[model samples]
Target chain A: MESLYLAWRYLVYHRFKTLLLVLSLTLLFFVPVGLRVLVQQTALELQRRAATTPLLVGAKGSSLDLVLSGLYFEGTRPEPLKGAEIERVQDSGLALAIPLHLGFEAQHHPIVGSTVEYLDFRALEIEVGRRFVFLGECVLGAAAAKELGLAPGSTLVSSPQNLFDLAGVYPLEMQVVGVLAPKGTPDDRAIFVDLKTAWVIEGLGHGHQDLSKDDAAAGVLKRKGSQITANASVREFQRITDENRDSFHFHGDRSAFPVTAILALPHDAKSKALLMGRFQSKDETSQIVVPSKILDQLMGTVFTVQDYIVAAVVLVGLSTLATAFLVFLLSWRLRRGEIETMVRIGASKGRIRALLLWELAFVLSLSVLLAAVLLLLTASQGGALLRHLLLT
Target chain B: MIRIQDLSYRYPEGGFRLLLPELDVARGEAVALIGPSGSGKTTLLRLISGILLPEAGRIHVGDQDVSSLSESERRAFRVAGIGLVFQEFELVEYLSILDNVLLPFRLHGRLRLRDADRERAAGTLQDLSLGDKMDRRPAHLSQGERQRVAIARALVTEAPLILADEPTGNLDPQTKGQVVELLRTKAGEAGATLLMVTHDHALLDLFGRVLEFGEEEGATTLVDREGAQ
Candidate 1:
């Protein structure tokens, strides 16, 4: 205890030196600890999301790309399989096969065109208003709503994939009819739209101006609105409403329409194996990918990198310890006269050495405390940022 | 009691050597050692206090042969037996004067300080007219005040032997007399033998016995210690 008291007095007397030592030591430890936490936290988060996604079947070009596009709705656009593929998967007596059509964005958030059943599949709940009921209506994820500041009755415009393709699909202004609860997943950054509305956005289904009443002489035409003025030049209805609900139609074979991928969950292990066998092919038309297995391979790479980081941190820690020891030795050497005085005053050399150790222990404890605080701050907020940039 | 027989000590580098044939001081005696600088007056005091061992002979303070003990054992013996005052007034600069006085009591197990120790330390400082400066550190004290603090620390332990080496070296004449008087009074009260080395012959009348060391010519060394070369 007397050793401790002397140590305390010395540290308090040389406060600036103590602070400098603590700060340097803390810098030496915080970075590695923070990176380690980020790696573990991200891995656990990614694995949890993969478990929720049972299996994803898409074009066989790249399984990684297919999984990224299908699960996150953000990646290279995969070759679209015919809609009948989803019907065949459903007919196989397997589990449900949910279709996804994602090739557009709104206010920089992915606009996912999927069925209402997808919501029930992901166990989502509406926090405000109801889901889409009309052709061009949409629902908002929690983050998307918070970012765009849109509630139930706001309107937003969908952006196309290729701006230079003038003859391709144009922008569609859809009504935000609902908002989802915050789920801390990639779904929280998407705009949910009906698959048919996605087809409408693709220019496969649309409502054009009627030219049945060719009144070239009168220079006017009667429309859904009670009154009609000039400037009735033919154009598309950007929004779908009950007044013109019947005017929308698709052109050709609906069964052969394109969808990006299909997310299927089998009922049992036997059924899942059967579905895998059905999609197995050496040819590169399409393939089945179990996201849980694929993510194991993905995280394997992450673990290798984590191992290297851990090794480098170990080396840095060793050198830092050496530096700290050298500093301690120099300080002790400077106090040789003081130590001699202490010995002359009946203080044993062992006792004085113990006092020095106490001083070092106090400094190290403080550095660990500082590192813990930094790790906690990063752990609390890293998930949101990672999901936004990588998952979403 | 202090006893020295056929004692001889020399530096490893072939420098000045000290050879004391025989000396003895009875308990509770007040003796003064007067000599020019480097005549081995302070060296003899250190050998008697178990601080430096002789190469040839033994020094016995009380019943223990200080030269025969290991370095650590000698330290414990010295802390229990002797109180020391020095020229530079070696008070720990960071500690308050009161804490410096109580330091010896806290450094070892047998001399562990308590409330009674605090009261005694306070009483010693009060006797030196330094009770009000107890909370002031050594840096804030004057030279005379710092010397008084050193004396208070020495006397607070009530050890059997007190050794002072040029304790008045940095003080004015008046302050020097006051410091010497305080040391004499405290050592007499504690019934401890007092040994002091000083150059001032005017204060010789204050001691019961006075001993002057031999001249510098009789002390031989391979190197001229006084020369710059």
Candidate 2:
């Protein structure tokens, strides 16, 4: 009790020095802990998303890119899979297949072209309004809705990926149908649309005039006062409602159209093995990748760098700890007179050492508390921090 | 009561040494040790308080052979049997004057803090004309006030022997006279054998006996005079 009182007095009397020591020690401990927590948490987050998605089938290049693009809705457009591939998976009875086409953005957020099965697979629930019922309607993810400040009945114009490719694609105006509730996932950052709406945005489907049928019987007539030519403007429906729903159609066999990737959910282990075998044909232009394994390998590369970085941080932390220890030693020398005084006043040598040790314990305990608070704050924002740092 | 026989001390790192053949102070006696700067006046007080162990001697404060005690035992013995008033008034500057006065009880550890202990501290401060200055730290007190606080600390525990080293060495004339009178009266009232080293000739009149140490090599030449003014 006497040691405690004396130590408290010293700390309070030299408060400025105590504060400096606490701040330095807190950062020294926090950096290594924060780095370790961030890496482990990021790996867990990425692995969770990847684990749910068993396999991704996409263009025959960077399997990591395919998985990242298909599962995470990130990266530039890879060579797209066809609607026929999705059909083949469905016909094979091997798995549930959801298609994703992401080569566009709206307000700097990814616009995902997928099927209604995508919503079911992700377990997304609408927080407001209804799901898309027309070709040009899109639903906003929770973060997207909040960031764009859009709700049901609002208009969202898809941002064309390439301005110079205006002939092939243009900014298509989409009708906001609903907003998804916050899921704290990557899905929260995307705008989801039906595959047909994605095709309209890609200029592969549209409402246009039948040039050969300038016949009055078909309701094709020249504007009475305006000049008309063989090339009549094909009216691309900017907004889709019940009236213009029939006008939007793909020009060719829609089954042959493009999709970014096919997310395959194999029914059983046997079917997964069988499906893996089927995609192994040498003539195949696509490859099947297990998303979890791909993400693990991707994280392995990151971990190598992280290991070196953590080692460096550990070295710095150790240096700081050594400096603090040295400071403690110096302070002990400085307080020799005080120690001698206490001893002369009938305090045992053990009591003097205990008093100093109690002071140390108090400071270190405070530093540990600071480190814990910092770690929790970082953990709470781990997803957003990782998204900002790596995903974009 | 205190007794020393063939007491000798040598500094381990230096060549300073002092050997006294014999010295004795009876119970309830007030003795003043007067000496030149290097005559071991303060050293004898430290030896009596067990702050320094004699190389070859037996020094007893009451019945205990303090010279034979271990380092820690000596500390306990000092806390239980001896009170020290240092020349420099070694008060912990961070603590309030009351805490400084009660320092012996705090470090003793066997003594529990009580209202009575606080009252004793207040009473000691009151005797020293510092009743209202309990909350002020040493840095806030005047030199004479700090000396009184140091005296209060040494006396608060009511130890049997009180050894003071130049207790009034730094005080002005009027404060020195008042401080020595208080020390003499209190030690007599408590019946604690008092031994103080003083350079002030005027204060020596208050002591019952005076022993003077001259500038001599390795010797505490006793020049004793008994007549308490």
Candidate 3:
């Protein structure tokens, strides 16, 4: 006990040296453990979301990009599949098709245009107001709502694809009707609207003033027996409301409209295999992908990279530990006079050894405790941090 | 308090030897030893305090046979029965003056530290005019004050014998005299036998007798206060 007391006093007297040693040891212990915990948590989060999503159908291109864009609403927007694919999947009776129209942004948040079934498929519940019920209405994810500081009755304007293109996609103002509850997933960072609204934002659908009205006669370019054509002076309705909602219409064949992907949920194993086999033909323009399989490949690469990182951290930790040992040894050398003094004063050999050992034990114990606390923080919050990193 | 008969010691490297025929000091005697450098004045103090064992003969301090005791036993005896004061003070710089004084009790398992021991240490520093400086480290003290702290450490043990080797060697002339006088007074007040080695002849008057070592053959001659050898 007395030896411990002396050791404590020695450490307290040289507090700066003690603090430096402790911080070095803390990093040495914390880095590898914290890295492992974060990687494991990221893997688990990715796997959980991917496991819940049965399959993804999109244009014939990068399966990984399609999965990432369809599931996470992140990364490159894949080549789009036609809206007719949803009808084909529905007619097959092998799966339920949920169409996704992606590739638009509102306030930097991805605008995910899907049917109401998409929300039910993902088990998303509204936290405020109600879901989008009109063509120009949007529902914000919890994170998006908090980020844009918008609630029900607030307005959000879609960002124009190109600021300088006068005839390009125009910014359409949409009304915020609801906010979704947070699920700690990518869904929490997206803005959801009806599929037609996304097409409207893409300049594929629009509303315009009625050229048949008597007040708009000068703007009409030509008039046939039962049809009329208007020039550029005609005003296009940028917002859809009760009075102008009926004016919003699509110009082309509706079945040919583009959707980024379709989430296919089959009834059983046979149904899933049949649906997967249907797109296996080389002549098929679209590909069907199992999300879990793609995610498994992704996690495999992540684990390999994590292994290298952990190895590097261990090597660095070993060197740091060696340096810490050298520091303690040099410190012991500097304290030779003090040790000699203690010896001459009748301090026993056992007591002297105990004093040194106790000091080392104190430093080690403190480093371990601090490292544990940091690892706990990483374990608890690492998923959310990883999600934010992957999304942005 | 100390007895040596026909004692002989030689350094292992072989240049010097100490041969003492006979020596005796009564309990409570304050004696001074003077010699030239390497004349074995400090060596004799080490021999009597059991810090060094003679090559030939026996040494007795109080009732214990110091030269015959084993190494561990000798260390226990040294910590419990002899108070040592060194020229450099040798106080642990990290410890305060009071902890330095209380150090002996903490070193050996035989001595259990108590509240009374703390009070006695405090009192010893108080008597040395260091009551207010108990919490100060040795580095913060002047040379005389540091030496006094060493003296307080030696006195706090309440040992039967006090062996000081040039306790004032590093002090100024005025501080040297004052330190020697304080050591003598403290040893007398505690009833401890004082055997101090010094090269300073002026302070010999403070002791009952002075033994001066001869440079030729390590022989010693006793000189009383009248300067008669």
Candidate 4:
């Protein structure tokens, strides 16, 4: 009890120095802790995404680019995989392939063009309206819908690639056929579409002709009653119909359009190994990367920086601890004459030592508690920002 | 009872020495050590209280050889049996008068401070005429009041031995008479052995015995004299 009183007296007597010590300890405890929390949660999110899908086959190019562009929603526009690659994987009979065509944008959001199978495997739920069934239809994720105020039947014009896109080469008005439920992942920020619609938006396919250009040229329009061959070959599928060919944006065959990446489930690790071995680049222009390995390597570098920060925090924390000890030591010395008086008044040496130690322990315990509170606040703040960054 | 046999001590730096061939203090006997300055009176008082150990001989307090005990054992013995009053009052400046008085109990972890203990502390304060100043810090007390607080602390412990080093040196003659009378009455009531060091010869009449010291070339010599009273 005497020691406790001494501790309280010391703290109250040196209030300013105690405050400074708490501040230094708070910084020492929270800075690196926050950084570690951010990095660890970010890596966990990336790892979770990576774990859901077994294989990613795209263009036989940089798998890191494919993972970044396809899975992480980062990186520049990737070189699209050919539709023939899908057929090749299907013919291999060792995997279920989901084609992803990404390159077009709608109001600054990337339009992810894939098949219905992709939606099923990704477990996306339609929150409003029906799924896309036509050429000009798109489905918006929750974040995209909320940000753009887009709902069912809302029409959205695609933003062009360049910031100043006066020429408007990629300007296609798409109707919002559905809005997706919130999925706390990168899916929340994307727009989904059918492969055919994606191909049409990329200027690869077209619907039936609405009119004849000959009659339009003669200033006589014909609609509803159009005469055309119903069994036209795939080669005749152009982005513009006969009547609107003059307004066609791009010239390409329907089957030969570009896609960003293809997500493939190779059934097992053996197949994954086989698939990866099949796609190994003999040339420097193409390479296959395991997403996990690449991520681990990236995180290794990130963790190194984090280690340095943690080390610095630990060193500073130790110094602050020393400061606290030094304060107690100085106070002990300052009160020596007083202690001697106490001894003269029948105080034992053991009691004096006990009082000193009790005071030190009391200060240390309070500072530790304060440090813990600060750490919790810092962790939660940093966690929220990271969650927003990764999910939305 | 306190007995000294051939006690001798050198300064910590070995530049000077105080030597006592023999001395005896009886129970209920308040003796004053009268001397000129630098006569080793304070050193002799410290030796009796176990604050300083004698280098060459024995100090027996109630048949216990204090100078032969280890430091820890000596500290325990001192806290339980001896009380000391300083000339400067040596109170903890940050502590209140009550706290200063009760410090011996606090340090011994015997801080029951129950109704009886508080009553005893209050009684000690009342004896010194310091009942109204219990809550005041030592720094706020006057020279005379601070001296009374120191004496109250020594009495509060109720030890068998009380050693005073120039307790009246900082007080005026009126306060000095009040303090000296308080000490004689309290120590006598407790049956404690009282030894005091002082430069004023007039204060020796209150004690039964007086010892005088002289500084020789290299040693302090002690002589005993019965007080005229």
Candidate 5:
């Protein structure tokens, strides 16, 4: 006890040196452990989400980008598939195709356009109010709701695709009908709207005042045999409401409307193989991909990278340990007089050694404890950190 | 009290050897040993304190055969029975004056540090006129004060034998005289045998007996100064 007390006093007297040593050792211990934990967590998270989402169908481009955009709502937007692809997959009786339109954003959160079944398929539960049942109505993810400070009955305006494009789609003020419970997934950060509302935001559909109305008479350019052409002065609705919703219309063929991807949920193994086989043809314009397979490959690469990182960290740790050992050796040399004083005062060899060992033990124990605390904090916050890394 | 018979010690590197046929100091005697440099005065103090063992001798301090004791036993005995003071005042700089004084009790497990030990340490510092500086480290003290702290450490153990090797070597003239006087007075009051080695001849009168080491036929010889007071 006395030796320990003396050791403690010595360390306290030289607190700055002791603290530097402790910090070095802490980083040495924490880096490798914390990195492994985060990598494992990221791997598990990617695999779990991808496993739950069985298959993805998108334009015949990068399968990785399609999976990233469809599952995580991140990465470069894949070339969009036609709306008719959903019906084509459904008619084959091989899978249920869920359309996704993901090019729009409101308040920096992605606007995910899908059918109401997307929520049920992903097992999302509404925490406030009801799901969107009409065009221009949106349901907020928990994080999106908290970030945008919009609850049920609040309105959110979509961001314009290009602020400089004068003839581009105007911003749409969509009504917030509900907020979903947090799932610690990409869904928690997305704003969900019906597919028609997304098409309206894309400027493919719109609501406008009747050209025959007397109020709009001045905005009309010409009329001939009940075919009227209106000039740009005609008022177009920026928001869809009960009173003006009937005025909204799409001018193109509905089947050809754009969808970024389709989540294909097959009936069973045979259906999954058949659907994948259908898209295997060289001339097929759309490609079907198994999400888990792509993610597994990605994780394999991540694991290899993690191995290199751990190796580098271990090398650095070795250097730090060597430096610390040198510092301790120099410190002992400096303290030779003090040790001699103890010896001449009848301090036994064992007691002298115990004093030195106790000092080292205290430093090592503090470093271990600090590293453990950091690792636990990383474990608890790993999901949010992975999301930030993946999305950003 | 100390007794040495047929004592012989030689450095292993082979340049110096000490040979003493016989020596004795009665209990409670204050003896000043004066010698030239490398005359084995400090070496003799180390031998008496069990810090060094003679190659051929029987050394007795009080009733214990110090030279015959094992290394660990000698350590325990030294901490309990011998108090040592040095020229450099070799106090642990990191420890406060009071902790320095209590170092012997803290160093050896044989001596259990009790509240009484703390009070004795505090009282020793008070007797040295360092009561208010008990919490001050050695670096914050002057040369004289540091030497006094070393003396307080030596006295705090209440050892029957106090061996000081040039305890006032670093002090100014007046401080050196005062330090020697204080050490003699403290040793007298505690009834301890004081064997102090010093180069200062002026302080010789402070001791009850004085022994001078001189070369005789290439061996060291101790001559008594006027037999005794």
Candidate 6:
């Protein structure tokens, strides 16, 4: 007890060193724990979003890219699926498909133009105003609402598809019609619009009215019979509409308009499994991904390296602690006269040793506790920031 | 009683050697060891307390021959049977006077001197005229007061042998007389054998015997014994 008591006293005496040691060990502990929490929160967000949509089908490529671009709204511009492909799924009685036309951006945030079902699938309930019903109208995620400071009537001009695209691509101005409630996931950062709007922004489709020469000559064609047609033109041209949309023109058939991907939801597991198998074996340029399984694989690879790094850091921390202890032992030898004085007073060596060990244990235990508390605080706060950064 | 026979010690640094053919002290005897700084007074004290072993020789304290004991055994013997008052008053600076005095009892096993032990330490400090300062740490105590606390600690366990290094070397004349008198009185009442090493020649008459260190040459009477003052 005396020896331990002495150790304890010595550690207490050197309060600064104890603090430094605790800090070093805390950093050693913090990284792994913090990363783990981030990973957990991210995976949870991904899984929650994935569950809402039963299936994600994209142009044949990395399944991970499909999930990232389709579900998480991340990754590069994947080749678009023909509008006919989505029609194929919709024509089939087995599944319901929602077309997602991505591959565009406005101010570094991706512009996701899809059917109303995308919002329904995400379960993003409106907190204020109405949903997008007209061309150029937008529904903002909670994060987008806060970040862009856009509300019911706020107007946002579309920036280039690529965030770093300084050359300025389609910079079309769009109106924000609604803001969705926070989903604690990536749904907060997305800009939702009608699929046609995405196509128009990509210069792949345009809004049109059939022109009559005689009616144009009569100067009343605007009020006469002019069939509204969906225009598909890959090339840029001029535009003319009630909205005075643009001068960019695309030359392509409306029926063959391109879509980035499709989200399918089957009624049961059998249908889902069958749909997934078909996509896997299909000759069409498409692949299906289960977000949950992909996440597990991702985490597996991540954790392997993370575990190794944490183990090495902890080993180094422990070794430094051991060296600190050795310094203590060596110092004890230098203080033999002082120790002898204690022994001569009837203090047993055991007591002295106990005091020494107690000192170190107290400091280490305190440091670990402080680091844990800090981790908790950071997880709670930093988690919010991460959701905003990675999710909608 | 304390006894040493054919004790010879060599410094690891190859300094002067210490050789004693015979040395003895009976119970309640007060002896003074006078020597210059490097004459091995502290080394002899350390040897007697079993802190250091004589290169070759024997050191017997009562019925136990310390030179024959193991390192751990010697530590136990030193804690239980000998009281050492260091010249520097090497008190564990963090502990209060009361805890310092009670330290030996805490160190040696089977000697549970908790509340009662503290009470005994209080009494010893009172006898050393330091009762009021029991709760104070050594840093707060003056030089004379610190020395008394060290002495009080040595006497707290009521051990049979008291070895002091330069007990009054730093005290004023009046305090030096008082300290030496206290040591003699405590040794007599406790039936303890006291060996004090000092350079102060004024205290020669206070002890029953004295042993001078070093060999004499033509100009220097290097080893001249002077009884207690």
DockQ of all predictions against the true structure, Cα-based? 0.44, 0.52, 0.56, 0.34, 0.76, 0.31
In terms of DockQ, the best-performing candidate is: 5
lDDT of 2 by residue, B1-229 (tens): 7888998887777676888888888999999999788788888888888888888989988888989889878888888788888888899877889989888777767667788989999998998899999988799989889988988998888888888999888898998998888888888888898999998888888988999987566555778788566
lDDT of 1 by residue, A111-219 (tens): 8988988999988799999998788999999999999999999999998768899888888889899999999777888999999998888889987554444643244
Q: Give the fraction of reference interface contacts each candidate recovers.
A: 0.47, 0.65, 0.57, 0.60, 0.90, 0.57
Model 4 lDDT tens row, B112-209: 55667778888889778788888887778889899998888888878898989999999999889888888888999999888888888778889888
Q: What is the C-alpha lDDT of each candidate?
A: 0.83, 0.85, 0.89, 0.75, 0.91, 0.75
By TM-score, the best candidate is 5
User: Per-residue lDDT for A1-392 in model 2, tens only?
Assistant: 88888888888877888888888899998988788788888888889999988888897988877877887777656788878998887788998888888888998889899988889888999999988767888999999999999999899999877778756577888899899999888899899999888988888887654334444224434544444333334455666667767767777888889999998989999989988888999999888889999989988987898899889988988998998898888988998887888888899978888889988988899999998999998899865687446555
Cα misplacement distance, residue B45 of candidate 5 (Å): 1.1
Measured by C-alpha RMSD in angstroms, how accurate is candidate 6? 8.5
Residue A80, candidate 6: how far off, in angstroms?
3.3
Docking outcome class, model 3: medium
After superposition, the stretches of candidate 5 with alpha carbons farther than 4 Å from their true spots are A147-150, A159-170, A207-244, A390-392, B126-133, B226-229
Residue pairs that clash (backbone atoms under 3 angstroms), model 2: none
Which has the higher lDDT value, candidate number 1 or candidate number 4? 1
Q: Which CAPRI tier for candidate 4?
A: acceptable
- TM-score of chain A for the candidates in order shown: 0.80, 0.80, 0.90, 0.68, 0.94, 0.75
Cα lDDT tens digits, model 4, A1-392, are: 76567556656656787677666656666566666777787778777877787777776656666777877565666677667777767677677878888777877688888887887888999989978775667899999999999899788876666758654344566778899899877788899888866776655654433235443333333334664333332133233333444343334654456767777778788877877776765753323456677666766876787799788888877887687668778878888887877776556767778777776666566667776776676555554466445334
RMSD value for candidate 5:
2.8
The TM-score of chain B in candidate 4 is 0.94
